[model samples]
Target chain A: MSILDYILGSRKKTANVAKDRLKLILAHEREEGGPDYLPALQEELLTVIAKYIPVDKNNIKVSMERKGDFEVLELNILFPDQH
Target chain B: MSILDYILGSRKKTANVAKDRLKLILAHEREEGGPDYLPALQEELLTVIAKYIPVDKNNIKVSMERKGDFEVLELNILFPDQH
Candidate 1:
C-alpha cells in the first residue's frame, strides 16, 4: 500500500499484547530536502502517536529505523522494571 | 496542588525542544488493587499521549519514574541516531 494508505488504513487489531504499541511510518521525497526534516519528521510522528495511544508517557519506550525514504518508529508501552 | 489538579491542569508551554514531549501522571487508591494496575496505567497513559502528540512514532523515546503512589511518564520525541 502507499504511504498515505498506510497512514489512513485501519490498524491491525488483536488482543492486548501485555503492552501498548505506537507505530509511525514516514515517507520522504527523492529531491533535495533540509537535513533537519528527518528528525523533525521523526518527532512529529512521535507526537501523533503519543496523542493517539495511551501510555505512562514516562514509561514509554521509543525505537526507530530509517531507510532510503522511509522511517519507522516503534513505541513500546511495556514497563521494563516490572516485566 | 493535588493529584487530580496535575492531570487536569494546563501543560506548561515552551518552545519546540528539538523534540516532542509526552507526560503521564498516575494516581492510585490507598486500598488494595490488582498488581497489574501500575503497568496497565502506564500503557494507557502512553497511548493517550501518543494520540495527542505528533511524532515520528518510530523514533520516539519514553522514560518513566515512580515515587510513593505517583508515576511520571516522560516521552522524548528526540531521534537518537540522528541527534
Candidate 2:
C-alpha cells in the first residue's frame, strides 16, 4: 500500500463505505419522495427525448425539491454546441 | 418567512451558496482529474447505451476514482423490473 492509502484507507474500502452511506441517504430521500417516482420519471423522459434528437443521458437531470406549500419538479438537459 | 426558513436561511439563497461551493469543489476535482475527459466519456457512454435499451439518466453515474497505481472508471446504471 502507498503512503496515501495507509493514511486514507484502501480505495475499495472507502468506496464501499461511501456506497453504503449513499444507499442510506437515498433511502431517506426515497421516503421523503415516493420510492420509484423520480427514477421512473427520469427513464420515461429519456426514452421520449431520445427519439427526436441525440440524448446525452449524463447531462439529463431530473430533480424534485419542496417549496413552502408544494413541490417542484425540474428537468435539465445539456446540449453541446454542435448538437 | 417560515420559522425553518428563518433559521436555515431562504432556500434559494442556501441553494446558491451550495451551488457556488459545489462549483469550487468541482473545479478542484477537475484539476486533479483531466478537466473535460470524465464528462466527455460519460456523455459518449450514455449516448451509445441509450441506443439499445431504456436509460435511466439519473441513476446512470460515471465516476473515476484514483487508486494507488492507477485510476478506475466506474459506470453504474439502474434498470427496473418493468420495461
Candidate 3:
C-alpha cells in the first residue's frame, strides 16, 4: 500500500470503492428501460454546460426517471463559484 | 435558521439533497425487475447480520443485478470496527 493509502486506512478505501460501484450500478439500472442514451447524453450535457461554465466533468451526474407517463432527466454538475 | 445550517451554508445542503434523491431513485430503479422484495430483504439481511455483528441498520445497502440470466445480490454494511 502507498503512504497515502496507509494514512487513510484500508476501510476508507473500501468504502469509497463500494460507493463508486453503487453509483455505477445504480446508473446502469436506471437506464434499463431507455435506449442506452446516458453516455451520449452525458457527453452532450458536458459539452453544452462547459460552454457556459467551467465545470468538473468528473463530478457531472445525469439520470432519467419515469414519472407516470412522462420522463424526467436530472442533471447535476459541480462548478467552481469563483474563477 | 439553526446555527449548524448557517455555518455549513445552503449549497452543501442542496448537494446532500441531490445525492440522497439520486440514491433513492437508483434503488427504486434496480428493484423494477424483482417483485419489490427489497424492503423485506433488507430487513431479513439486517436481522441475520445483526445477530452476529452489531451493524448500523441505516447504513446497510442491498442491491440486486442480473448477469447472463443469473441474479446477483450485493450487500454493503458499515459497522464500527472498535467495540
User: Which residues of candidate 1, in runs, are more than 4 Å off?
Assistant: A1-18, A33-35, A57-59, A66-83, B1-83
Tens-digit lDDT string for candidate 1 (A1-83): 32222222333355223332333322222222424244554455445444534446676655555444333344444333323
What are the Cα lDDT values of the candidates? 0.38, 0.34, 0.36
Candidate order by TM-score, decreasing, is 1, 2, 3
What DockQ values do the models have? 0.03, 0.05, 0.03
Docking class of 2: incorrect
The native-contact fraction of candidate 1 is 0.00
Which TM-score values does chain B get in all models?
Answer: 0.37, 0.44, 0.40
Candidate with more favorable, higher DockQ: 1 or 2: 2
lDDT of 1 by residue, B1-81 (tens): 322223223333552233323222222211223242445544554454445343366755555454343333444453333
Candidate order by lDDT, highest to lowest?
A: 1, 3, 2
Better of 2 and 3 by TM-score: 2
Model 3 segments beyond 4 Å from truth?
A1-83, B1-42
Off by over 4 Å in 2: A1-83, B1-36
- lDDT tens string, model 2, B1-83? 32222223423453331110100000001122222333444455356545544576765555555543333344545443341
Docking class of 3: incorrect
